[model samples]
Target chain A: MTSEIIIQAIVTGLMMGLIYALIAAGLSLIFGLMEIVNFAHGEHLMLSMFSSFWLWSLFGLDPLFSIPITILLLAFCGIITHYFLIRYILKAKMLIQICATFGLSIFIRSIAQLLWTPDFRNVDKPLLEGRIEIGSVFIGQPQLYASLVCLVAFFGLYWFVTKTETGLALQATAQDRHAAEILGIPSNKMFAIGWAIGLGCVGVAGGMMANYFFIFTDVGINFALFAFVAVALGGFGSIIGCLYAGIIIGLVESLGGLLIDPSFKLLYVFAIYLLVVIYKPQGLFGRY
Target chain B: MDSRLEFAKSEPIWNTNNRVFSIIAGLIILLFALPLFGMNSFYLHLFIMIFMHAVMAQSWNVIAGFSGQISLGHGAFFGIGAYATSFFYMEYGITPWISIFFGMFVSAIFAVLIGIPMLRLSGHYFAIATLLIGISFQVVFQRWDLVGAASGLWVTMTPEDSWFALQFHSSKVPYYYVFLVFFLITFFLVWLLSRSKLGYRLRAVRDDPQAALSLCINVSNYKIIAYVISAMIMAPMGSLFAQYILIIDPDRVFNIEISIIVLLITVLGGIGNVWGPIIGASILVPISEYSRIYLGGTGGAVDLIFYGLILMIICIFRPNGLISFIPKDILERKKQR
Candidate 1:
């Protein structure tokens, strides 16, 4: 392959990776706080994408303009999911917790199908149309904006979790719920906040992707699989690990698709995931 | 305390073991006689599906419930079994009866290869790895030209009915009886395993691997054994499914939904118990069948929603499964009286 083509692939892969990082950030945060892997997390992204698409189609609002609305909506959804469904099973068996989320995923997907139908929907005349050419390389406007938004969101989340007192409380709750409770952190409320932030990240990703990608009930599964790989590859609860792992996965997927058959791209991603899981279960940056 | 003492002192009206045996015998007799009553093909197909799902769920229970290894890629083994038998039949004109064993052996080998590396990861990591493994298998098979690629492979129909070929010309009765035998064998093996020394070791590993390791139990070995056995049992079911449907596809056999369905059935019934899968399949199959008939094209969505609700409700209200809700007091009272 030519150097230019490789560079192009890397750029495209990096853009895709940023969105994946956004989706996986929520999953990692939730896992860190409650030790519960949200199997239905992908569905939340799907719902947000649909939300963005509808806002664009019905009100002529650009997907870029609907980002804040989608984030808030998804954050509310995260809160409701935690309050009604997840809270009760917090102390249940591992299988129960996993199956509950898996069921929720099915429920959300089916509900979307029932309400909006399964036909692929896209934002018409998105604000970021066309591409920008820089010397020998060109980047799609939608992808560039999406990556920029994702980069900002990632840093914003990192700052919130590390700098703010509320963020420290969330971290403390994740580290030791009993100790945090003794310190008057209100573990339950912290958990709820974690869900909101985590899901809100996915909401941002969904809105951005809605500008460029097709929207459907099952679209989340396609992206969610990658997010799962990214999170697992990055270590379960490490935000920085998730970011780097997401990028690695995206590059592998894009380069593998170019080097090998496109159909085998997913195979390469899974191969890397399996290898990492077997050899480095703690991930590259994870302390545990 | 006084009531408990009095209960212990009471004489039993009947032998509990004998009564249980009689109930099972009566149920088996009923099952056998149903085909003779000229039931419709649709109900027969439904019962066959129930038996198939029950077997699949029970096999999953061995690894997930008994050994504490949550595998989300069991459908890969099932697909292996289906493809093994289908390919054997299509290419060498081998009968499914013999090729079913080939499928089982292949699945067992595959299980060992994957289980060794995968079982090293604990909890959610193992689950996610298995899920990806299952997906990768689907992707490879979809792109593979040897197995007819995405179009899938079909079992050629013989002109005349042949027992050796595992095909029937006229009725679904043969299929039901064949599946009944499959169900019985799987059920019997699970029952026997639950009461055996190996079962105790598996339970020990599942309950606490660290404790099991301290007690000198080879945790990984037992887990691999459970996984291989589960894969072997599931493989035949895939072969049976392919034969029943007369078609096999990467998506149909290797889909993540297949693995999820088995997981759901086992969880709904009560994991680790021998009878749990049967009870779960009995409840779930009918609901799905009826929903499909009543709801038509949107039936899939309705069923998906219904299953999701059931799973959530079960997780919250009855995490031990519906089987646990059975009144122990009633059985005890009948025996004591």
Candidate 2:
């Protein structure tokens, strides 16, 4: 590939990495605090896509403007699932929680499929049509916008965790739930917040991702696998680690296609994951 | 060994409930014979699929159910077994009878490599790690290029030989008998395992690895052994399944759907119980197959919804499986009488 092609590839990959890191960070936070893997995580993203897609198609609202609506809607659904279902199995074995969420995921995916057939849907908004050229490399308006949105959302999260009392409670729960509870942090409410943030991250990511890939019931799986690998590589439940791992994963997917088939990207990701777990069972930045 | 046998005899063969099992067993035999009367290929295919799936779920129950170490990569082993036999037969004209056993051997070795390091992890680590491996195999198989790459590998071997080819064309009856043989073998294997010292150790490890280790059990060894045995059992079943379908594809064989269905069945049927997956496969597979007829094309997700609901209910009410829902005290009373 030429220098221009390489630069463009890197830029595109970096943008993709930021989005993946955000999605994975959401999943990591939920698992970090609540110890639930959220098998329906991808489905939540799918839900947000359907919500945004429908709103835009039906009401002609701008997709970006529907971001808040998607976040609010998915957060409400996430809270309900956590309270009615995941709350009871919080302290149980992983298999049970996995099945519960796994089932929940399929259930929701089925509903999405029922409503939105596996057809590609797109929004041709004027705001998303332009591009910015830096030197010889080019970046599309949507990619740049999505990347900016991801960075903004991430910083907002970082600020909330450090400055806000509730955000502190969420972090504390992840550190030590029992200790947080003893400190009068109301661990349950914090978990609910964690769930909301976890899901809201997915909502925002989905809204942006729909700009790149078409919407479908199973569309979430493509990103979900990447996020799962990123979390495992970055160290489970570590946002910083997810950021590092997500970019690495993105670069691999783009560059690996040059060395081997693009399909091997997943295989390479897992192989690296196995090596990490074997060599550093606690993960790259894992506290556990 | 003698002392262990005496200890086993003192505890009792089964934990009560003779009447119910006998009735259930009788019903199963009748159900197995149901296709004999109908001669309907559709129902026969469905029954055969149920048997193959039951065999797989039962094998998974050995590790996940008895030892509580769930591997999402079991689908990879299933794919390996099927592809190994089909490829060997197609490439070198090797008889399937021999290739099938080799397939199990290959799967067992694979289980050992992955399971040795993985089985030590507790809870979600183990599950997530296994999922990564499953994805790994899928991507690797697709890229190998020797196996037709992403388009998927297919064996055009004719279904001519009855015994050697493991293929039949006359009617679904022969295939039904073949699957029955496969299912019966799996059932016996599980039965023998659950009654043996190895089985007890697996249960102990699953219940609490720490406690099992404290008791001087080689927890890691036993866990790996359980995985190998489970993988071995599943491998041949995959070979049989591949032959039955007369086509072998990575996506079809190694689909995450296989793992999901097996896990759902084990969870639904009452894992660790010998007949749980059979009960699960019998109930769920046919329904899923039938639903696909009505639910396919337009983003059909009905089967997924159904399977997910069953899994959730099981997790909430009876984590030990449906068998746990049975009143233990009543069974104990029946045993006393």
Candidate 3:
């Protein structure tokens, strides 16, 4: 492969990795706040893409402009999921907890299929529809914009969690729920807010992807798998770890696809995940 | 307080008392005699599906229920069983009976190879790792030309019922009886497991690995045992499914949906219980069949949506499963420790 093609692959991988990081960030945030793995997380991304697609198809608003709306819609969904489903399983057994979210995932995906047939849909002509040449390498404008937005969002979330009081309170609750409660922090509300923010990140990433990637009910499964890998690689509760891990996964996926078989790209990623999990069960940045 | 303690110690989940045993025995007898009624193909097919799913759920229960290691990639073992049996029969002209053993052996070996590294991680980590592994198997098998690739393998047709060939083109009744035998075998094995010391140790490992370790239990070894047994049990059923359906494909055999469906059945019936798979399959299979019959096609998702709702509701309200609703008095009887 030519150096230019390799560079192009790297750029593409980096952009895709940013989106993966943002999605993983949401998952990591929720895990940080509470030790629940949302098996339905991929469905949340599916919902976001659908949300953006519908907005564009019905109102003729570009995905770029529909970002805030998708974010709000997904955030609302997160809160609803939290209040209605998550709260009940908070103290359930591990198997039950896993099943609840898993059930929600199937439920959401089926509903999506019911409402919108499984045919792949895409934004016909979004505002950002082309590629930009940077010297000898080229990048899709949609991918570039999506990656930029995701990068900004990742930093923004990092800031909110670290510098803000509410974020600290959320962290406190995650660290020790009873202690945080004693300190007058409503851990319940923090959990709901955590879900909202967590899914909001998915919303942004999904909406951005709707510009280029196909919008479909099952689209989230693959992306969600990547996010899970990123979260596991980066460490479950570390935001920055997701960023680095996401990039690494992206590069590996693209380069592996370029160098080897594109079909086995997922296999390579899974291999890395298995290696990390076997050697460092705690993850590269995991506290537990 | 002493009586309550005794009651608590009683393993009521099995309900091994004479009355319950007689009732269960009668039910099995009835099932065995079902083919005598000359039921139509549809009912027979449903029964066959129920039996097959029950066996699958029971196998899963060996691991997730007893050992508390929820593997989301069980389809890999199932696919191995399917592929191995079908490949041997299709290519080498071997009987499925012999190939079935090959499938089980391969699955057991794969389980150990997978379980050693994966069983170290707990909870979501292990679950997702297995899930990814399952997906990768599908990807690999799809591209593998040796196994017929994406087009899958189709078993040769037979004009008449042939036990040797493990095919019944004339009627579904033979397949029903075949699957019933497998189900009963799996059921008996699980029943035996519940009474075994290995079962207790597995339960110990599941309930408290740290405590199990302190008690000198080989936690990882027990888990691997449970996992291997689970995989072994699952493989034969895959072989049977391939024989019965006369087709084996990567998508059908290796799909993650198979794993999830197995989970739902075991969870719905009752996890960690001998009869959980039976009860779960009895309820779930019918719902799936009827829904497919009536609410299929453009409304295809109705059943799945219903299943999803049922799963969530069960997880939220009846984490112990529908078996919990059988009345504690029936499931539990006063017994001396």
Which candidate gets the maximum DockQ versus the true structure? 3
**Runs in model 1 with CA error above 4 Å?**
B1-16, B328-337
- Tell me the spans in candidate 2 whose CA falls farther than 4 Å from its real position: A1-4, B1-6, B9-39, B150-154, B157-161, B293-299, B329-337
At residue A247, candidate 2 shows an lDDT of 82
**Mind listing the fnat for each candidate?**
0.70, 0.66, 0.78
Q: Against the true structure, whose TM-score is highest?
A: 3
Against the true structure, what is each candidate's TM-score?
A: 0.95, 0.92, 0.97
Q: Report how far residue B312 has shifted in candidate 3, in Å.
A: 0.4
By summed lDDT, the worst window of 10 consecutive residues in model 1 chain A runs over A278-287
Q: TM-scores of the first chain across all predictions?
A: 0.98, 0.94, 0.99
**Which stretch of 10 consecutive residues in model 2 chain B shows the poorest summed lDDT?**
B328-337
Task: Kindly list the per-residue Cα lDDT of model 3 for residues A115-135, writing each as its tens digit.
Answer: 998999999989998999989
lDDT of 1 by residue, B237-285 (tens): 9998988887889999999878988988998998888888999999999
Real A-B contacts recovered, model 1: 0.70
Better of 1 and 2 by DockQ: 1
Q: If candidate 2 were superposed on the true structure by all CA atoms, what would the RMSD be? A: 3.0
Clashing residue pairs for model 1: none
What lDDT is reached at residue B68 by model 2?
A: 84
Tell me which of candidates 1 and 2 scores higher on lDDT: 1
Q: Give a tens-digit lDDT track for model 2, residues B1-337.
A: 3355456657766544667667757976886788768768988889888889899999889988888887766798888888888888888878778998999999999899988877776666677777767667776777667776676656665646567777777777888888887888788878878868888888889888888898898998999999999999889888888888877666888888887888899889877778788878888888888887887665567788788887887788878787676776542324234
Query: How many backbone collisions does model 3 have?
Result: 0
Across A173-238, the per-residue lDDT of candidate 1 in tens digits comes to 999999999999999899899999999999999999999998988898868888888888888899
